[model samples]
Target chain A: MQVNFWDRNQLRLTPVFFLAPAMLLFTVYVVYPIFSSLWISLYEWNGVGEMFWVGLGNYIEMWEDDRVHTAIWNNLIWLIFFLLAPLISLGLSIFLNQNLTELRFIKSIFFFPFVVSPVVVGLVFSQFYNPEYGLLDFFLKSLGFQPIAVLSNEEIVTFGIILAALWPQVAYCLILYMTGLAGLNREIVEAGRIDGAKGWKMFWNVILPQLRPATFIAVVVSVLGALRSFDLVAIMTRGGPWGSSTVLAYEMVEQAIFNYRMGYGAALATILFFLLDIYIAWFLFRVWLNEKGRL
Target chain B: MKLFISIIVTVSVVITTAMAGTLKITQNSSNANTQKLWKEQIIPLFEKENPGIKVEMTIYDHEAYKTAIRNFLQAEPPDVVNWFSGNRMKFFVDQGLFEDVSDVWAKNGLDSQLSAARSTMTVKGKQWGVPLTYYQWGVYYRTDIFKKYGLGEPRSIADLMYICRTLKKNGVTPFTIGTKYLWTAAGWFDFLNLRVNGYDFHMSLMDGNISYEDNRLDKVFDIWGDLARKGYFIENHASLSWQEGQAPMINGDAAMYLMGNFVVPNLKEGGLSGKIGYFQFPVIDGNVRTWEEAPTDSVHIPTKAKNKADARKFLAFLAKPKVQSMVAEVEGMLPTNNQSAAPTDKFLKIGFKVLSESAGLAQFYDRDTNPEMAKEGMKGFQEFMVKPDREKQIRKRIEKVRKRIFKK
Candidate 1:
């Protein structure tokens, strides 16, 4: 029997056939693991042992856990400051893009940090911040200022690391903004100029709205990057200065892998995943509503 | 056709023979000389002693080694691997991943040759590994700085505090440390914990029989805080490696560094060997103390070892005095075997003396405590170093961890 061309069933199977590869990947890596973690989170297994069912004990204990609170606060700080990183870089990119002389070279140099591995960046910045023979200390001493223990002082430890983290993140944002600028509508910009819209007025009215796609991507990535800040913290301080820099990601690794509290760590990870999911959903919803309003 | 068949058969026989002769071993020790010695001396000796046994060894740096060992133990356990003693080994032992070496220990008379403390190599009354070497952790200081300031090696806590005050007066940092790795702070805490609480208390605390919030731990925190508040450590310690922090100590900018005996190599690498001096971590409360934080290294044969008998033979060969002494000489470590000759390296001699003379040897805090508890406890200790006022809170957190880890 010959199959009918352009039939509804054929059309329905077409979409499934196209999606089969991605669906398989998702099932293996994402969907299955989510349920596996959920099941594991209810047990008191140390990754090796007789798995004991503890019900919601791990999740319940997370409520009174101060480390979790510290981790959450650090995550919030990361999210807040991390957002500013891309904004500042975007602003810088726009400003730099306005000047055409040797711009590409300068942008490339600025973007160099993003190209390097976070582990290498962390090690380099750690040396730069070293108290005794570090460049910062030498500069401070030359200026007759007492050296600061930036890495050890709990009060400023997070900010110290954030500065290191920002180095690469800012570069990333600049690259995104630069790409967005390259694709900007010249005709619309010319129209704005004809309408006497220039400088801040032109940017606010013409350029920024046109850059929404880049801005949205930048924000989403920065938020996720900030929430998932682990490598730099691990390399630089290992969430130290007395766990002042203990973000959720580092804490999860510590609890699950190092401490062998696989169940508790999984619970922490699940919470972080859900938290990010909620934030992203809210952000996308806001952006969708804004677009609908524009329409 | 006959020539081609002969060549193919010869190739197949050679491949099979190579595969049959190969013996695999993994070690977590990161010392460069140790790796070199393993390749040049240990492997050759083992191979010579056991004809047709070709050894393949993989070495890991400290942190990577810990993670790699855990990974390997879970996935594909190696034939023979270096591991720590005390509660650290107990976890793997409890999993039945290690071969019981009680017969080997008894046959070789290791029980009487090694110290009672080394019994930590055994779990559930069955010996599971062969102890190779151990070393003391203490205050390694710059002799030039001490001589410049007319300060003697600190004999007591009062003397140490006085030296700290003197160093501050002389525009020198009293101590150099890098808490970036977190466990460096544990060296200080281990000394303070031992001094403040004594040996029995330390054992009890490690075994989870004592609460972390006990006044003894508070007193340890108070001492640590006093050191911090007094500006004893170099200004930017947190940014330095335990080795990098030694630069200030080497340059005479810093007076002392509380570190393991292994730090001597790094100090020497930075061109400060001859200028360095060692002292036992000072006594508190007029007590003449001889406790040392001695982390021991051991080799265990896995139950799933490809060549179990060959692996056991390699472990036995490593336990011999000559092999231990040769390794000690190359690695600048104190050998576990009493019959092994002392390392000729001056720094290693100091370590040997300290380890030999100690009234009691406690495994370094991280090794003495179970790995799970050690992870949280060390982090808490690092936090305590940064914010002393958080002592009560940190103690409570540690107590909770203790309860979770030690729960039956």
Candidate 2:
């Protein structure tokens, strides 16, 4: 085959030409905002006024802020508890991966929470936790137990909001796992079974290894979701009962919008961005290693 | 068909040319009745009186207005906008985002008519806005419940404590407050601080001159903590909104709410109109003079307003006694114009008397303080109500915020 210099140049430029628009969009929407936020974090600017260079003043203030401490602690707690979604979803998906006709209906019921909006979920859970006239209160009283106001108590309010978030999150993870299960190799499972692997051993040894991609996706999504948990806290609690339920994302919005501390809020957002960036980098590195090993 | 289209275009042009000025107003009011009065009555009356100027008004819900005003004032400035008084108004005034309307105040003799709110509206000896309406904060109690318990309006802290004890003995919560939004708790803090440490101390605290951990505030917290620890407040108050807090009071499960005159309509809707009664927060110290929380809503021209002349005209119109009287009647709030007719609503009448007799007026806590400090301070107040034992910790946290915000 005879190839001219134009054809070689055309081949290289075609991919670049195709990628230019996406790269431009990504730069504008994603990359530029990150740098803009980083720049804004160094200034003491109200949303509508002159920007005063404060350098690390905002970060220093955030470091000593008790609310920031509370928010960071709440984020950590959310990260820890949100892992349960994938683990529980895996079990539920395995149980429902059957041929029974009735199981399909049961599976849909389990998927119901994911269909509802997070706002509605927060409101429903808020009513459920209402001490004066809620279902939990009613049941507790009927059972001769003290009615606990879950959302009001500072010590347990974060847990209460997490439980509400977990409902939809577990459903989301279950769907991911179920699709992964459907694509599993039947021959490998049969080989494992014929080699005397059965039940727990067969699932753990054969089925689990096949679900790696799904597991990886589920974990990454769950971690990101946990880190950005603003809606439920904003709706159900508003980081109330003295901000005991606040997370970094909610605090950032509260600072920026409600408190009109735009510079401080930018600093908070920068911190969150870096935290997310480190996780993503680690994830990509692990995936690269996996690919290199396979090759 | 061509002739008809031409006629339509000509008519629209004529209509547009007939009006010499377009006055745009953006108001922050969540009250449907108030919005209706503005659209149906206020705007029509203004336009009818000033045929050459067409007035346009847009109302936003309370919270949305806070952020929207910041953007529009910088980008597309309205002719006139409604805002708060005190430090809340000063936030924009200092930035020169609000036009100096001293001439309007002077031309209309608003200095004397709106003298009550003049201090709040003034910065560096220049008037920034015209006061619209104000409402008092006090204890709104069920008169029937008080009668049943044989308790007259509390005269002093001791007397209030006795009433609280009586109500508690009868198995009713003495006070109903919701701290979900946090400002409601600041109302309690304002009254307590005013009563215990006096108005000057309270103002100093709001200005960030006094630390939250200052010993002068110790007595105020002690009283508040005592009330909280004694179970005088409704249980799980941190979970409800200010509106939801009224449910207990309306149901007779709770006796009183320390709120503004704005709660009157909600109480009336809750079926406690005739039975509801108002009283000033009782004295805690004989030496301290009485100060009232009377947050005033006001109107101003943005510095970037296109029609400054008409905006001033609109402000002067709003300053008139008759217009203010209508505002007071429709809103069930006290008119800021001293020459305005007395408010017709019974609750507002009492509120007027209380405010008029007071030695000084303080805008509500959140309004008087820096926005950042107010938020943290209100949150601390809410926490104190929930966990009275954490008073020291909460105060320390609020003080930290105060230092950072005020650079103290």
Candidate 3:
């Protein structure tokens, strides 16, 4: 059989064409909703009534909304704590990576939390924080300390929820670190050892730098996870102890779906989207700059 | 070719069997015994009485069913779905989404059976749904706790404060509530609002004829703030579900809960059925005792339903005295049909007594108010619970929302 140049090229490219379906599905389901939500932010609709063009009214409302302010503050706390949580996990992973007798079991136990769903994690932690019957309260009472309602008081509720959120997140980071450690070059470690690089010096100069890819993945996921902190809040508190635990994602769902204020909810959602975008952009820019310097 | 022919025949048989004019009903009510009775007693009766008809049923958790119903209405609505009365159903009604049963209301004699109070369930002066059951909301307290603390069922605001003081000294949380969903707080606000300002204020607010900053409402907030400041409510009430908070009351760790008759079942589930006691939320002043809280449940046929005739038949069947009595008995609720036998459950009997004795019934806060205003208003109520000092700020914000929501 003879084939023309166009036919030959087309035949060669059929596999790539076959991938179009998945790409189309992704764009339709994921990309389109993001853009549509962004567009909806510019109007005021209560899901049933006529949509009024609100321009930037919803965004402006964010400035005056005390609940939104509290949410943003809580989100900042989540980002800071969530970002550092991964480093702690990585440290633990490295500690456990040493020649310990039960290292395999220890690692598996540490990784167990990540395998659980956030809803289960939230429920379990909420029970732990329960004032009357929870483990923490029981321990505190036994110690003759005042057993506080960790999930209720406005002063500490956000911190309690974030602690719950960090459990699964730390496990996630550990998995990444363990995988990164597996890919580490033994030759490079030996070369550092031969050059008198040992212990902290060895880890700081050689091992840490090599773990950059894993660290980048960890930070990105953590930041995104912190910004999208809804399931934990929903399961644990539903933005309560009087809206003290509301995050933007939860507020968006509550307003858009339950409250039927689609436009206002979209506006809140857009703010979350922008906040996430800025952090992700900064992260990528830093990575790009570092790569350029290496080049 | 033989296999393809066989597959086509099988598919046809399945479709024919599945779509045999069967009526599908979905509800969020999850009382297992009631569900069993509905299947074994009601369904069989409904099916046998109307030969060649079948009934299929599905139940969901309340929030899940709300989401499901909203989605289904936009896609494939059921023949009949249980729903809330008042403003919640109005959105569906306004969309031309529910079947107008004004004729059915008159034909089944519900117009007379249900009374003028039932008109709240109507939209645009047309009856769009059937009121299945409703019950009174009041203060449910642990009698043992009250007796131990030397307190009695509060009849007035001063008496209620006295009881709170007694309970506080005794180291019990004066009230137990979970406001995680925000609307539960509205129950307190609604009782206070009604007690402080009476039924007229509530009706005006529902009609969008009253301002959020009305002095009458301000007085309600004042009382709410006073209770909050006095530490009458459980700390961290916002972190728990209403059911979770019920535990403290059951265990005598908390002395009281402001709730509806539906909570009696939960109290029974908590093994406090005999221990629980009730009274109308104490009046702010002696004159305000006439106002009462009564939220209703109703079933409506959607306009877009494929089986409207069957749905209407089901509605008519539900309105029958026998079916009403069955629903009331199994569900432990007050039947809307006057001819329906009174509930045998003691707590439900108390609820019926309260309903009959009250001068008037006010719809629940969330239902009585427009949904848009209700959302913002309920959040304000929650905020007021959290920080009484936020009262002025919440009122201002609510005023802004009210204007925006009900603009002329």
Candidate 4:
């Protein structure tokens, strides 16, 4: 009847003790903020003074807000175009996966964009896109064409910024793919070659399945990057020529900080969280399915 | 429990010791010259004059300070804070964030000394802060270009149109502006509104009393859009910043810029000192009085300030003619105190004269309006500048924001 106290509870207590730090941090910083932002969205707070209850008012306002519509459209453009990063980088990784002696130099050159900060990239691109003294204008003028001010034109400003964002993003995905290519199963490749699978067939049938984890991560990162695009838009355009190039994240910050509408900003943040959550849930479901198939 | 009690006691003692005889001041200034003036000159002077009171100053970057002040005012406010006059000041005043310092104004007789800026600093007929310095906004032109085109300073809308036509005929852009930051476009809107409808109407519009689609504003945009449509502004101006817009005038591609007195220093730094000339924005309506945009910077005591008496002393000291003149000289701005020595800089001198004769002062478009309205309004102005045909849509969009913010 007399049991050892440590032995009886150790199974449950050990895991809880070990997980406490992480769980505490996650709850405080992540879980708490997500709910708090949702709670804040149901009010009319200007960040400093009073918080008046106005349930779903902020979200209802979003339905009528033109800037919100523009932001959502821009976010869609970013997402669609961002998927190109992984596709382009996969090709780049494959091309660089050669036995040439100078491939290391080329690989490092390809990886250079990822090393630079986004702000630095944005500034450089801004200078490059300048109408009067920019490289783009210089090229256009030399080609006997009228210079186009890409960043100023609302139609093309988002695309111009996306191109700048893609420079670093492509390099990031390239690094991920290179690692995947490097860690490929040599035995499976040889067996595929013996079975007369060459070039695209060998890679698509054998190598790709092995690189699933890396592909998943790269696509997920790209999607996240596209959804949360802020710094480049802030630096290059400031959501201008009149809010044409704003994303949800930038609008959220702009509303909270510049416009001083904390409740509306929280509503924006909440919407973004839901969008990200849906993608994450789908990703988790896919991974669970894959694990079951493996089992 | 013993350790906890000891820690609490230690913190309280440290805080009280830190608070005693120390006056903390926070200012929004990113300029190294201003920072150095405060550290080496202003603080030293204040501390020297008051032997028992020590001055501690913190300077935040201009844009960062806008957001930071809101948080710090509620959490841990400094004794004195520097901010703009007009609606920006009224915003905090309405929230009871800033202390009413009419006593400081009355005791020092700033009513007459800083009369030009008194209206802006006053909200609900009580002075909220002490005006320190302000700079005028006008048409900064390339004097050489004007002379070459046989153009004198335009006195009326007709003369301005003639100047524009003459400049455009000579293959020179009539004006250079960068609407990339949006506020530069607001400057144009401010002048146009002030000139066409007058200051009272402009102030009412800024207060969200008048709709953006009002007939009064149609004339404002009509004049503005005519310039935009006539290709009077520098090409691809929407892509350029206020600094970048200077390149066109500096290179003589554009003839003029309707900008603040701050641009004079930039012009001087760009090595076009004497070549630049200041002129009041030309008259649009003969009957309407001339109103100038002069953004005034001032100091205030926060409601929760620990050492309010010392803060009042700081504000009073800041308002002194000698101190004002010295600070103004360092900042390359005109002193708000009329009793201060006249600015010796040529452009500053002209600005001071123009402002002295103006019917009333406006604190520029963005400063005089609700922050949300300012953001949307400036965006609309920038859009209108870029696409003149979109004026109606832009005005309607801005009107939507105005209605929401003002509950009209």
lDDT of 1 by residue, A1-295 (tens): 6667657488678989999999999999999998899888898877876788999999999998888998999888888888888789888898788666788678789999999999999989888887866788899999999988777776787888888999899999888898999999999999999999988999899999999888988888898899889999898888876677889999999888888788998898889889889988998898899899989
Worst 10-residue stretch by lDDT in candidate 3 chain B?
B115-124
Point out where model 4 deviates above 4 Å: A1-11, B1-20
Per-residue accuracy of model 4 over B116-137 as CA lDDT, tens digit each:
9999999999999998899989
TM-score of chain A of each: 0.91, 0.94, 0.92, 0.94
lDDT tens per residue, model 2, B24-112:
89868887888988988988988888877888888788988888999999998888999999999999988889999899988889899
> Which clashing pairs does model 3 show?
A241-B238
Q: Candidate 1: where is the Cα deviation over 4 Å? A: A1-22, A283-295, B1-22, B217-219, B285-289
Go through the candidates in order and give each one's DockQ: 0.57, 0.73, 0.50, 0.86
Best by lDDT: 4
Q: Estimate each model's TM-score.
A: 0.90, 0.94, 0.91, 0.96
Q: Residue B180 in model 1: shift from native, Å?
A: 1.9
Residue A215 local lDDT, model 4:
92
The global C-alpha lDDT for each of the candidates, from Candidate 1 onward, is: 0.82, 0.92, 0.84, 0.92
